[model samples]
Target: MQKLLEGLIKFREIDFEEHKELFGQLSKEQNPHTLFIGCSDSRLIPNLITQTLPGELFVVRNIANIVPPYHESEEYLSTTSSIEYAVNVLEIENIVVCGHSNCGGCKSLYASDEVLNEIPHTKKWLELAYEAKTKVLAEVSVEEVDKREWMTEQVNIVEQLKNLLTYPFIREKVSQGTLTIGGWYYLIETGEVFIYNKENGLFELAN
Candidate 1:
């Protein structure tokens, strides 16, 4: 807490002062162009990784960067609401769903029921990635846990991207070519990003 307080003071004293003009303009309104959906991992900083400034990327961080399939009857969801605001209200054109290496949420998907019972809510939420896990398992056996986990993380990103399309407005914009979606995988130790290439159906290192 002390460290965060000190950092807040420093932000006001130095960083904020240095970017006073930019912050002043942003204080009026934010018109971010991209909606960045990333993991709630502290190591993954969306703006820092993309080298974007304030008011550039509207971010939504959640466990495993999951995007629940859109349902018309569902109401008052933080992720779904924010995504609607970003697309319909803010008119954001680009959306990036980023997944990182060594994610706790992804690893938890492989946890036994007894272990998952320790964290009920977390276990329930991770059900969003079950499809990804199932897809991986259909092709590979449990003996290869490491490969399964890695494939789960990658498949989860693409699965989330697919879920994003379940929203009517988002689908409309995408169909009209006004909005675009992207899936990204970040390697924490190497500081490298891989983007999903739809043409090749593979993740390739970002150029």
Candidate 2:
């Protein structure tokens, strides 16, 4: 608590003072450039990774960085609604779905029922990412822990990108070349990111 308080004071005294005008302008409205959908991992800082400032990236974070396929029944859809607003309302140009290394959410896809049952809601939420597990299992043996982890996290990014296209608006925009979608795999240990290239269907170093 004390650390957080001091951090807040530091932000106000240094960071805020340096960007006072930008914040004042942003107080009225935010015109973010990209819709960054990333995992709710404490180590995965989207702004820091992207080298973006406060009003630059409109971020939506959830466990595993999952994007549920477009649906319209009657449930509280936070991430979906945020994507809708970023595209339709904000008219944002880019959408990025980022998955990271050593993600607990991604690893949970391989968890035993006994383990997952302890966190029922998380189990349910991870259903959106089960397809990635299926792909990983088919490609690599579960006994190969490192290979399984890499495929699970990166394949999850591909799955979410596919999910994003399920939205009619997103699909139309993508087809018309107005809105672009990207998949990113972040390596927490090495501070590196890989970009998925749909052309060759490979994730290459973002550098």
Candidate 3:
């Protein structure tokens, strides 16, 4: 709490002051061009990773960076609602779903009933990544933990990219060539991000 308070003061006195003009303009309105869907991992900072300025990326973060397939109901869908607003309202040009190496959320898919029972909501939420889990397990051996870790992370990004198309508006925009969609696998330790190539079904280093 003390550190956060001091950081707030420093930001107001230094960072904010330095970006006064940018903030003042943003105070009027924001017209972010990209929608960034990522994980809630403390190690992955979206703004820092993208080198994007404030008011540039509309971020939606959650466990595993999952995107539940489009649905219609009288439900409070947090991530869904954010996607709706970012696309239908903001008219974002690009949607980037990023997954990272050694994702606990991905690993949680394999958690036993005893462990997941402690957090029922989280267990339910992780259902979205089951397809990715199934795919990775089919190809990787249990002994190859490292391969499974990265494969699950990358495959999960591809799954979410497919899920994004489940939204009708997004599908229409993509079909009409008005909107672009992509998946990214970020290596936290190496500071490298691999871009998912849909045509090749592989993650290529963004070099």
Candidate 4:
């Protein structure tokens, strides 16, 4: 808590002062260039990784960076609403769905049913990874737990990208050539970012 307070003080004293003009303009409104959807992990800092400044990237974060399929019947879906607003209102041209390695949410998906049952909401939320889990199970032979985890992490990014397209606004934007959707896997240990290439059906390090 003290560290956070000191950081806040530093932000006001140095960081905020350094970008005073940017902060001043941001006080009026924000027109971000990209909508960054990433995992709600303390280790994964989207702005730091992307090297973006304030008001540049609109962000939506959740466990495992999951983007649920569009559903009108579902009430109080904040993630979906944020996506809609970013595209329709903010007019962000790029939407990035970023997943990271060593994700607990991805690990939980592979846990036994008994363990999963303890966290009912989490179990339901992670159902978005069902197809990814199935694909990993079928394609990847996992003799080691770490290998299985790595596969799951990669597959989850692919799955969420598919889920993002389910939104009508997203589909429309893509069709109009006004928006580009990207799936990213951030390797925490290696400090490397891999982007999914749809044409090749593989993830390559982002240049």
lDDT of 4 by residue, 1-207 (tens): 999999999999999999999999999999999999999999999999999999999999998899999999658988999999999999998999999999999999878899989999989999988888888889766566787898899888988888888998899889999999999999999999999999998999988
| Error of model 3, residue 53, in angstroms | 0.6
The whole-model C-alpha lDDT of candidate 1 against the native structure comes to: 0.94
* Cα lDDT for residue 135, candidate 3: 94
Ranking by TM-score: 2, 3, 1, 4
Determine the backbone clash count of candidate 3.
Answer: 0
Expressed as tens digits, the lDDT of each residue in 47-102 for candidate 3 is 99999899999999999999999999798999999999999999999999999988
List TM-scores for all candidates, in order: 0.97, 0.98, 0.98, 0.96
What is the alpha-carbon lDDT for the whole of candidate 4? 0.91
Worst 10 residues of 1 by lDDT: 71-80
Q: Per-model C-alpha lDDT, please?
A: 0.94, 0.95, 0.94, 0.91
Ranking by lDDT: 2, 3, 1, 4
2 against 4, candidate with superior lDDT: 2
